[model samples]
Target: MNKDFHYFGTYSAAILAGHSHEDALRIARSAFFVDLCTQPVLNSVGAPIEAATTMLAMEMADARSDIISQQDVTRTWASFHFLPYDLYSERKGCGKKYMQKYRLICKPNGDLLVDTVTQVKGKSLEATGLAMHVLADTWAHQNFAGTPSRVINDTNYHFFEILPDGSERRISLRPNPASPDDLIKGLFTGTMRQGKETSVMNLGHGRAGHLPDYSCMRYRYLPAWADYEEVIKDNPSDFMHAYCQMIYAMKYLKGEGGTFEKATYDTETVAPYKEKIEAIFEKRQTDDSEDWKAFGESLSGQEIPDFDTPDYLEEYHKAPEDKKDDTPMGRFILAALAQKSMVTNRVYKSGNILLGISGDYKDWGTKGIRAYLKLAKEVRKGGVI
Candidate 1:
């Protein structure tokens, strides 16, 4: 697979510059490494120091992560709940529609030590730190392919509850949640949340466009696991102004006969129409599509096409009271509970008592090895060319 150009060059140089693998890791943990996430800069001679730094970091991470037993890391990576697409997009980050939960791997041992994979939208520093952790974990695990001595973060932490009766209770918390969905939601909620932007829909709507804009924005939010508020801190009025201008300009583009060269208006200019702008995006994919068409055809074949609206709209629209059972959230909760029980059962079977628990739990050898292989295979042959 192709590697990131900038990351390749810098990492090669670091190795040649008498830096050990450990030193390279430490360097990556620095603030300077975080800066490489943006565009590259040049030194006095224009050697592309910034590019080199990124290249080095990537190489370092990849090379170290490669130390694993060379099983199919790519395949396992693909099965991850995250990275919904083959390549994680930068232009369109995570938007309102999609959210992900992540695992935190500890360094040196590549142990999945931490349950809370903290992520802050709009907070570059925090995101950078998380990225560094991910890279470090990847490297350590790849390098050390043997069975992990212990599961990462298998110890218990203290949890507390504040009751309405004005008393507090301390409870022991397991390292990871019992249910997969709950674990996923817990990791998601613990690591990410609604920020000043308040809603993903708002981020998708932008100032003017709908579905496409929302989709684009979603790409950005997804990869970074960002908070909209943090991104807008530097330009509080950016979304508002951008939305108004896009709408005004769109009118002219769509033959509305509006002036294309109007003077810039303040954020207040779009306030009245913001709600409408948001609506357009929410319904972007409402139009007929192949996916809907295929489903409609299938429903017809099954003799279940009795509906006022087309079969295409049936899935999107809500069913009647008797038809509607579990909301998406409810289904998610049930799944999470089931996963928790399974994991708990596995713990019991392992006979390795959890740190907080009085009993024992079993050792699930590095199943992550397969996951990593899957993830690596996702890297295209040409490497995002």
Candidate 2:
């Protein structure tokens, strides 16, 4: 989902879950930063540099150093939860089936999400926020896969546009077999990216772009090779469902419940928060704004300190070494790496790939945990990883 769910909606859920306003804001910020923490840059002397601020600066930077592995941890966490199409399905010659497993709303794979969240509940608020990101996407990205597949996502050359009044009219989509550059262009121009026959970095939502993540968007498509079409209506139920799940998960995390019992969508449990949620959406729409910082501040009922500024770093530098994990940045980094081993081994590579099983899966988790701890220690020393 968009920041509407990731930042604002998550904050609301934390509040509803009985967290203090300050704790709720931190959880929301961590949720949003999961997407923002992709870049890992190196300084002039080849020292790894952390993103001082959580704001987007152009496109995400590539992983370059051991220090950059922190970014990889976050990226990997995101891939498991959001870009989950990497796991192969059991069906033969049906890569699309693998992709469909993560589409929770209209598919049978939501149990995987619920189980994953249940295992990770009470680990930490940061971890819970990470799981929430994945849970929210199961609804917003119901039909799309995390991996790039031409047959599953590629649409025909036909074009359609949704007018201001919610009516659609035919418009020009970009030429067929759209290149990566063409796909980028189509994102800005509101034109569809026609799919290519071959697979070549045509990853998730490249054909549809970010429309699937927009809460206000409704789209329909007929795959060039498919017999039927898929229609996605603009609905808020997905957001409502996410909010309800967050509440339920929080209860389990708080030890109030032993297990997470999935609630029916739009049930009475979430009905009370519907008006508040609608008001948040209405204010966002009326303002036509995507300023997450301002929106988060409004939800937090306080002004947040800018972590990118030097003053924040000065305070960070002065904090006691043993108390580092209690600091905001330290807590975020620790939580990012905390569950890497479990997710990679148990969730991503649990004999789920296209190929058959190989070695002991527990070994994979062991190796991953070792690597994360080594790199995290290096980052704490001097950000040299």
Residue 371 local lDDT, model 1: 24
lDDT of 2 at 253: 71
Local distance difference test, each candidate: 0.24, 0.49
Q: What is the TM-score of each candidate against the true structure?
A: 0.16, 0.67
Residues 1-385, candidate 1, lDDT per residue (tens digit)?
0011012211222222233433332222221222232112223212212112222223322432231311112111211111112112233454322311112111221112111111111222222222232232222122111111112111112223233244544322222324221211122111112232222111211111111111111211111223221111111122233334333332332344433343333235345544543443232232322332233233223221121222212321344532321322112112222222222233223331220111121243324323222212322221521
- Model 1: per-residue Cα lDDT at residue 189: 12
TM-score (C-alpha, index-matched) for candidate 2 = 0.67
Instruction: Give the clash count for each candidate.
Output: 63, 3
Model 2: per-residue lDDT, tens digit, 315-356? Answer: 445668666556554555555554343344444344443211
